[model samples]
Target: MSAETASARLADIQSRIAQATKIAGRRADDVTLIAVSKTHDAAAIQPLIDAGQRVFGENRVQEAAAKWPALKTATHDIRLHLVGQLQSNKAADAVALFDAIHSVDRPSLVAALAKAMAESGKRPDCFIQVNIGNEPQKGGVAVAELPALLAEAQAAGLPIAGLMAVPPFEVDSAPYFALLAKLAREAGLDGLSIGMSDDFEVAVTIGATHVRVGTALFGARA
Candidate 1:
């Protein structure tokens, strides 16, 4: 996409976020918009960066390592987030690269991340991913097991930022968003990594602190 198109798309999303936040009586700045830039190469992502998007999300650690080192060196203050399921073995790489990791779902990964942080001295903010829909195929701590995982993560000394979830597809997401918010409140966490391109406005209204927007910002993936 061209720089102008990228700016326009980002502006439109920002405007929608503003409207949603206004309707919800929340400040627009309270919601951080993470442009999901997974799969798109540097050439494609540059336009969005030029449009003043500083925060981006990638799905894989390897892909992010491949692209983001150069991108981050070239640009200042760019925050990269890992918005995909992360393996325990990749904990060190993820810790070294991402400013935040939004997929902490299991105790083993928490232990690995804790070890990585101890060795590397880099503590990335972590959001425990909850399998809100309880889909077997999904990668998250089951809702019932959330407390255990959260307790374990806290015990490991990880920087627990908040919770993250992806609700079931083709469903009204408000209830799910509301439930996630409730869980966050109960856990005493303030950050919420819910919402995506399709329903971010709804997520915002329900108190999402971070919305992972992909197609809406980068256009449909190839």
Candidate 2:
């Protein structure tokens, strides 16, 4: 994508976010827009950076490792977030690479990340993901098991950021977003990392502090 194309896309998304926040009676600045840049190579990502998009989300630590070091070197302000399911074994790399992680779901992963943080001397803010719809294939702690998992994370000294979830696809996402917001509030978490391209405005209305938008910003995957 050209710089102009990226700028226009970013502007539109920002405007929509502002409008959504306004409708929700919330401040737009309170919401952070994380352009989900997963699968897109560096060539595809640079335009957005040139357009002043500083925060981005990526799926895999390995892919981000391949792309962001150079990007971050070029511009030191970029904030990278890991927005996909993370394996326990990849905890160390994730901790070292991401500024925030939106998929800290299991106790085993929590334990692994704690050890990684200790060993690497790098601590990344973490969001406990909840399978809000109880989707079997998704990677989130069951909502019912959330409090215990949160207690486990806290016990291991993890820097808990908030909660994240992906509502069932093709379904109305508002209820699930509302549920995630409620769960986050109940857990005393101020950050909510919910929403994607299709439902981010609704997500913002419901109380999403961070939105992981990919196709809406970067366009459909080729």
Candidate 3:
């Protein structure tokens, strides 16, 4: 995408976020817009960086490792987030690359991440992904199991930042977003990694600290 296009898209999303935060009686800077740049190459992503988008999310550790080292070197202060299901085996790589991890779901992955962080001395802020809709195919801890998992993560020395969730697709997501925010409050955490391109405004009004927006910022994937 052209630089102008990227700048315009980023501005539009920022404007929407500002509007939502205003309606919610919150500061716009309190909402962090994570430009989900998964699947886009450097050519596509650089424009966004040039447009002043410093934070981005990628799905895979390998893909991020492939691209971000050079990108981070070229630019400065770019934060990368892992917003996809993380396998236990890739825990070290994920810990090394991402500034924040938004998919800490299972005990195994939690253990793996703790070990990786301890050995590497790098603790990326972790958001426990909760399967709010109870969908069988998703990668979050079931709602019923969230408390236990949170305890385990805390005990394992994982930096429990907050909660993350993706509501069932094609549905009214406000309720789910509210539930996630409530869960975060009950857990005594602050960050809410809810919302995407479609419902980020709702997510913001409902108290999302981080919105992982991809399609709206980068345009639809090929």
Candidate 4:
């Protein structure tokens, strides 16, 4: 998309978020927009950045490492977030690069992150991803196992910021968003990193503090 197009898209998304927040009786500042730039090259993403989208999400540590350093050097205000499943081995690299991690799911990852954070003296905010729908292929801690995972993560001194989830597609996402919000509240976490391109407005209405918008902001992946 052209820079103007991307700017318009960003404005539209912001407007929708404003409307959704109003409907929910919440201030627009309560929600953050994470532009998911995974699979999009720096060239493709620059327009969005030019459009003033500072917070971006990437799915892979390697891809982000390949792209963001130079981009960040050129644009100093950029904040990167890892919004995909992370391997324990990549924990240090991820901690070094990202400003937030929205996929802290299991005990092993929690331990790895803690060690990495201590070694690097950098503790990026962490969001526990929960498999709210019990999807077999999804990358989240099972809801049944959430409390245990949270305890382990907290014990490891991870900055437990909130929770993230990708609901089962082809299903009405409202309930899933609501469920995630409910789960976040029950866990005493005020932050909810739920929502995406298709359902983010609904998610904000239901109480998502962060929305991971990819396709809507960048257009479909090639």
* Model 4 ranges with Cα > 4 A deviation: none
- TM-scores for the candidates: 0.99, 0.99, 0.99, 0.98
Kindly list the per-residue Cα lDDT of model 1 for residues 1-222, writing each as its tens digit.
Answer: 998999999999999999999999999999999999999999999999999999999999999999999999999799999999999999999999999999999999999999999999999999999999999999999999999999999999999999999999999999999999999999999999999999999999999999999999888999
lDDT tens digits, residue span 1-222, model 2: 999999999999999999999999999999999999998999999999999999999999999999899999999999999999899999998999999999999988999999999999898899999999998999999988999999999999999999999999999999999998888889999999988999999999998899999999999998
Tally clashes: model 1. Answer: 0
**How far in Å is the alpha carbon of 100 misplaced in model 1?**
0.1
For candidate 1, the 10 contiguous residues with the lowest summed lDDT are 213-222
Write one digit per residue (lDDT tens) for candidate 3, span 1-222. Answer: 999999999999999999999999999999999999999999999999999999999999999999999999998799999999999999999999999999999999999999999999998999999999999999999998999999999999999889999999999999999999999999999999999999999999999999999999999999
TM-score of 2: 0.99
Q: In model 1, which runs have C-alpha deviations exceeding 4 angstroms? A: none
Among all windows of 10 consecutive residues in model 3, the one with the lowest summed lDDT is 73-82
